[model samples]
Target: MYVAVKGGEKAISQAHKLLAKRRRGDTGLAELSVAQIREQLPLAVDRVMTEGSIHDPELAALAIKQAAGDLVEAIFLLRAYRTTLSRFYVSEAIDTGGMRVERRISATFKDLPGGQVLGSTFDYTHRLLDFRLLAEGDAETSSPTARDSEPEPEPEEEAGPMGRVLQMLEREGLLVPEQDDDQLPADITEVARSYPCDRSARLQSLVRGDEGFLLALAYSTQRGYGRNHPFAGEIRVGEVSLTLIPEELGFPVEIGTLQVTECEMINGFTRLPDGEVKFTRGYGLAFGQSERKSMAMALVDRALQADDYDEERSSPAQQEEFVLSHCDNVEASGFVSHLKLPHYVDFQSELELLRRLQSETDVAQPVEEQA
Candidate 1:
């Protein structure tokens, strides 16, 4: 006997209640606080901030807690919240050269003027597990250092803006000279409305994009789709000034600053216009610490800028519009998930065709006998 199953609403309600209970598990332990998560789980916070397009560690921590530690869901939550925010003003381009660098390094050059500072990184740490930390009051905790032991340096007054490293290469005739243009660069918003082409805007979109999607696209390039040997010229993470120009004020105002990651990739190329061999550069920047993504983005950026590189077309990665437009995860997810909806009519049509084919095949009769 077949019976129609109902109570979908009841089942959904129960599931919600169960989820709530699971999220707030075990009353014995102290509940996870937003501040604690923000401070302790800073890497997670950085990922959320990078993908969320909003740089609030507290909010990201709250979203992470609310989403039950599902990083992707937390990103979605942050993105949704960002949509409700009103845009009061647009900030001027940040001077990254003047950043108060916490960590900076270059793969292209061993020594630079600022010098490489390997701040906090797990690169040198061993992967061995330490069971001592599992027990309460295990080993003697390290004593706190004196406040004046490493006093914070006062902010510099006359720090001259340094030109980009690639600019120096161009001057030395090692890199392809950047074409000079008298025309002013078009505004990003206006270009987005018509056709998105600005590298800054494209990079901004990729910064908040899904890590899985970005990683996959980057992986594809390495797997012979658009293979290009890339060298990380520089990778920097630090705080930069945010200056805003209010329409009414007609003067730049200093807004709150933010920490960001910037990457410059040098790629091999031979210029076509002059038939000269010179290095080409790709750029990537993102909010917070995301060196991997930024580096990958820079590689793809250079590949798409192949025309600018004067390299002969060979791969899909060289197609700027195709690569940039289809790399978004949200759009891909929606299109894929939409297939799960009820398509009774289409299913019925497919079923009829399959049945007809089966019936014709089932009728086993010799050709000679039939004739």
Candidate 2:
């Protein structure tokens, strides 16, 4: 055991040195700059920003570099950094209705007030790799110039401030009524989470939850466990106006816009507080261009609201405690990784106990067997 422990310590040290060498790659090539990661790998940076719950691109880039491109590690780094910053003031909730849209689409509607704008997407692209990218200096000239081609402008109603589809349903008396705006919502970050949490707190936990875990849960719902037959009422990618009220100013002032991905999903049914059944909505919003994460969040959000529909809550996705408890990657990673730490004293105690039990058993054996 002593030899094994000493060997492990030496092995770990050597492995770390090798890892540092591997991370640095070739000495002939220039080291990758943080700015290059920020600019070239925007999607990856966006994911780090969204999952990390921090908005600074430069810091996210640094975390990405420090973690050697491990997104979860980067998120953990950023989240740790976020805890150290001094709190100044809280920003007001953003209005998605007033969003300056970059891309917007809906699966439920073939044609709406705003025509679908397919901007900067891989949706229709073939998944084939060019192979030309492997050749040095070939990537720059081989890039497609699709941006140079401009299509005709969409209709005024389609291009202009397109209203939310579900809001239209609400006006026409087809959707479930929303909660009163006057009530103060619970803050999950400020308060510790418990089972049967309120909607606001549930959503707060989910926004910082693991995207892959939420996606799996959302996918499970579609496969018939706690199925809600959801429709994408709107999946919007845009910049929303952020405003904050200063104590001295008395009135709210526009701080700056934040890029976000917002999804509004229309559930099949929900029983209202007044015992009336109506179509309900599930909402999700995330930092940066994280459409998939937002959509998954909305699906899981509705699944957690199964009690509202009086639906059978047998599925794992419908259980609030199970979902909320294991959804954080940081918590999961720490717990799993801690198993690698030395447990020599604990194991030694267990070994001694077994030896004592064996000795007692030998002494209790028959004299005939000893002969």
Candidate 3:
């Protein structure tokens, strides 16, 4: 007598059609274009690029529009697309010092060799809602800046291999010099023996990590979990060279360039094991202008670097394997969502236990009455 959901397929098809109509909204209005989404919702695009691990703003914007402004869904779309793409070649380590600087600032220093360029940022803007933006035909373009107002580029002075700012102070005998093992950084994928260790790969991972996870890890340091008085030494955003070492050509080849944001945090520290005092440093880098994430990442990076600083590592943020491995949004999302899938067998076992308990309670009630 139980005809088990015979129209399940029909119902699913009808539901999908209804969803499509709802998402499209009233057909009388002009549909949102990809270009409009790209220009209007840039912050969403930036988040998609950062969390999705894709650098193309246009593609990220498209994903955002397709996902109906759901940032996590946009990230998922980008991540899925990224997996399908083939790796042609690995680029060389970009020279951050030689970046075509767009935005640069330092909280630690008032005047650095490179004067700060506060490019396009929302930092100083008031948080009040702009009603004009919600209205059609109200958007206006500002006049372009005068060409003469541009600042001259810094001279091509080959700064010695961009050493840690703190390390420079340590060299003057003002701070403690941590022991340096001559061990070269292992080729990250050598254990698998497939991919090589390169700046591109490292940046790719950082940009795609969950924003909230990075923020939390960074906050832990300030909250006394790791305890570091971190000052944003410098935060820079610009484009850097991407080079490839071809198998046929032994020398590195200039493939192209990419925009990147780099953050360096200086921490106050009293050196131990040698009774020396010195400033320590932490570094973070990512693709695009993700200053918040980059800055947070820098703080977390510094806290994790405590092991190198000879400081006690008791915090979860200091654990490299734990932090780096679990910071991915895709992994977190999948693991969390997977729990919603059918667990009927497990539910049945729980139901049986509850029934047994109820039966035992009923039997005890009669025994209690007799007593």
lDDT of 1 by residue, 1-371 (tens): 12344568988899999998899899888899999899878888888888877889899999999989988778878878988888787688688888888677778876556566655666677967767767766854565454736844532422334346676788888886657464455543245513437665566666666666666666677777776777777888889998999999999988788888888888776655787678877777877777777877887777767666556657776666776666665555557766776666777888999998877766865464468
Lowest summed lDDT over 10 consecutive residues: which window, candidate 3? 191-200
Query: After superposition, which runs of candidate 3 have C-alpha atoms over 4 Å from their true positions?
Result: 1-10, 13-15, 143-206, 249-251, 272-276, 365-371
What ranking of all candidate models by TM-score puts the best one first? 2, 1, 3
Q: How would you encode candidate 2's per-residue C-alpha lDDT over 1-371 as one tens digit per residue? A: 22135557888899999977887789899999999988878778888898788888889898898888999999999999989998777888788888888888888876778777766677887999978777766775444454766854655566556788888888887787565677667776677897798888889888889999999999999998888889998999888998999888989999889889999999897667787668877888898888889999999999998887777899989999999989989888988887777778887989999999988878888675578
Residue pairs clashing in model 3 are none
Compared with the true structure, all predictions reach lDDT values of 0.74, 0.85, 0.73
Clashing pairs in 1: none
TM-score of 2: 0.87
Per-residue lDDT, model 2, residue 237, is 88
Superposed by TM-score, candidate 1 places the C-alpha of residue 162 at a distance from the truth, in angstroms, of 6.9
Give the best candidate by lDDT: 2
In candidate 3, what are the lDDT values of residues 140-249, reduced to their tens digit?
66754746467456534332233344445667876445464654434332332122223333334455677788889889888988888888878888889888899888
TM-score of 3: 0.79
User: Candidate 1 clash total?
Assistant: 0
Could you estimate the TM-score for every candidate?
A: 0.80, 0.87, 0.79
Clash statistics: count for each candidate: 0, 0, 0
lDDT of 2 at 311: 75
* Best first by lDDT, ranked: 2, 1, 3
Model 2 is weakest, by summed lDDT over 10 consecutive residues, at 1-10
